[model samples]
Target: MKIKLGLLYGGKSAEHEVSLLTARAVSQAINFDKYEVYPIFITKVGEWIKGNPLMGPVDTVESLKISKETIRPNSITSFLPIDGDDASHLDVIFPLLHGPNGEDGTVQGLLEVMNLPYVGNGVLASAAGMDKVVMKQLFNEAGLAQVPYVHFIRNEWKNSQTALLQKMEGNLKWPLFVKPANLGSSVGITKVANREELLTAVEVAFKYDRKIIVEQGIVARELEMSVLGNDEPRCSIAGEVLPTKDFYDYEAKYEDGTTNYAIPAEVSPELLEKMKDAAIRAFKVLDCSGLVRADFFVTDDEEVIINEVNTLPGFTPISMYPKLWMESGLAYSDLIEELIALAMERFEEKQ
Candidate 1:
């Protein structure tokens, strides 16, 4: 019998559109003969809608967004995969979601509670990886070299705005990159070269998350590597992100078509080795499963800095994660198949 695979996409987070795109890509690439594909979309307003298993691969994103009229919004009853919810039962789930509610362990927790095997990082890894400050702390524990930075919550920033500003200015260098502690896809990241920009950036970041991180900007090359598997995860060859803009922000990453990627980045053998080691170390430190996109910064002097690890990194055909793997000789469809197997393996181990 064909395995039942549910494609969980469309979330309440800012990366909702990216999720839709990913669902479309996965559907187009999925082996229909091996697994029956189902669509479970979470609308922008947080509606849980389930569509029937596709007779073939999805041709457009609009088909994937069609909701079953019987299913109510925000209803968990349909997702439990129990007796009452017959059609929702599945062998595995591929959560093609990025950022916040979907990628930050909230959805993972739900899957765990329902005893369903879902692809990607578990609760601990997802939660830790979602929060920049927490991920940095884990990197520190793993002996990872990272840039200097500071973090604060909305309340702290409000109560001691002056002190926080002073601390940030004193501790970090100029041209800082401020980011929402618990968001991804560069949703609320801002590059500030001065005090005025810093204040504005903080307010903007707070709009997405309660906490914010301000890292000292560095003059270094942006490199990324893909990590796959569970206990014995491995890293792919490094890829470079070349942004036409001042920095790689939300627009450059997914919109505006201003970002260019260099697959199999030009790195010395020694530097590549260092990056591979660092990426695997970050993966193991967070106890990540399935896959992770480990992004880094290599300075002019070849100094490697751990920027951050994306627990559920972009999985589109053009996304760095899959592109890096493809350069390493893994086809897109095979990569997805491997991730699903790894998910089942992790779930069995948990049981």
Candidate 2:
């Protein structure tokens, strides 16, 4: 029997649009012969609707929107088989979602409860990877070097405004990056050069999440490596993010086509090995499975400071994660197949 793979995308997240794009890309690349592909879309309001098994590679994003009828409802029932459809392959859910309920452990936990297999990290890793402060603390325990940062809940920020400002000013340098504790795709991130901008950035971040993290900005090259596998994850060739804009914000990542990338970044063999080591350390430390995009900040002297990992990094044809793997000799379709195989491997191990 062919594998029943559900392409789970879209969420009540700021990264919803990106998720849609990922779904489109995956639909285009997936093989129709080996797997029974299904579209499981979660609308912006958090309604889950599952589409019929795909017949072939999709052409347009609009074609993948699905639903000429009213939304069946966003509950689990929407994804379940009705009376006649007995052999539907929700066998594995390939969650191509980003941020919050999608990237965080919420969706993973739901899958766990249903006793179903899905792609990417498990509940513990997903929860930790989604929260910047908690992820940093775990990185620290692994003895990974990182730029200085301070984090606090919304209540703490509201109550200790003066003291918090004092603390930030004393500890962190100018040109700070403020971000929501639980978001991705740079959804609620701001680059601030002074106190006024920092204040405004704080308010902007709080709009997306109750907890926020502020990091002292570093002048370093942004490089990333893709790690694949479950118990023994392997790192891909390094990819560099050269943002012409102020920073690689959401716009530079998706909308604007200006961000330049150095696939298989020109790092010395020793530096690449070091980065690979750090990446695996991070993957193992988080107990991540399926895949993770381990991002880093490399200094001029080639010091590899682990930044963070995306539990479900963007899988679009052009996204850094899959692109890095492609550069490492894994084609996009093959990468998807590998991820499905890894998902099955992880599920079978759990049983």
Candidate 3:
């Protein structure tokens, strides 16, 4: 029998629009002959509605916004079959989601409880990856070189404002990037050059997440590598993100489309190997499965400082992860197939 693959997207996240774009790309690329594809959309209001199997690739995003006539607020019963109803039995799920409610282990936990096989990292890795502080701690333990950063919760920041500012000023350099600990897509990240900007940035970051992380900004090239598989993940060719903006913020990532990319970035053989090793080490350290986009900051000296790993990276056809893999000789459709196989393999291993 053909595998029943459910594509989950449109999450209640800052990256919801990107998730929708990814779903559209995956629907177009998926091999309809080998598997039956279904759409499981999580609306902005947090309702889960599953759509029927696609006869062929969806041509438009509007066509994919399927709503169950009977679906109620926050209910997912429409997705669960009644008393062994085979129609609702999904062989696997490919979650094309990014950021908080989707990639931060909440959806993964739901799948775990339902005993459904889903793509990408498990609850632990998802949760850890979403929280920058936890992810950095794990990276440190893995002996990965990282930029200096200080993290604290909203309460701590509010209670010890003066002291925290003093600590950051003393330790970090002039330009620091303040970010929400549990968000992606460069949302709620601000580059502060002085104490006045720092205060405003911290306040802005707290709007998205209770905890915030401030990293010492480094003048280095932004490089990224994609790792695929479970247990033994392999690294893809490194890609560089050359942002023309002040920094790689939300607009540079998705909106403006001005950021120039150097696929198979100009790297010496030794530096490439070092980055690959660091990427693999990060993948293993996070205990991540399926796929992860390991981002890095490479200095002029070729020092590879591990940045962070996106458990479920941006996956549109033009996104960095798929593009990097494509450059490495894996077509988009083949990458999707491999991810499904990896998902099933991970599920079977757990069983």
Show the colliding residue pairs in model 3. Answer: none
For model 3, what is the error of residue 224's alpha carbon versus the real structure, in angstroms, after optimal superposition? Answer: 0.4
Task: Supply the global lDDT for candidate 3.
Answer: 0.89
When summed lDDT is taken over every stretch of 10 residues in candidate 2, the lowest stretch is 68-77
Clashing pairs in model 2?
48-74
lDDT of 2 by residue, 27-120 (tens): 7888888888888777778777777888888777766676633343334554454434555437889998888888889989988876778888
lDDT of 1 by residue, 1-351 (tens): 999998999988888888999999998889999999888888888877778898887778888887675455446667676666667788899999988888899999988987999999999999999999999999999999999999999899879989988898899999999999988888889999999998888889988889999999999999999999999998899999999889998788877999888998999999999999999999999999999999899999999999999999999998999999999999999999999999999999988
lDDT of 3 by residue, 279-348 (tens): 9888888899999999999999999999899999989988899999999999999999999999999999
Model 1 / residue 240 / CA error / Å = 0.2
Q: After superposition, how far is residue 138 of candidate 3 from its true place, in Å?
A: 0.6
RMSD of 2: 1.8
Candidate of highest lDDT: 1
Error of 3 at 349 (Å): 0.7
Candidate 1 TM-score to native: 0.97
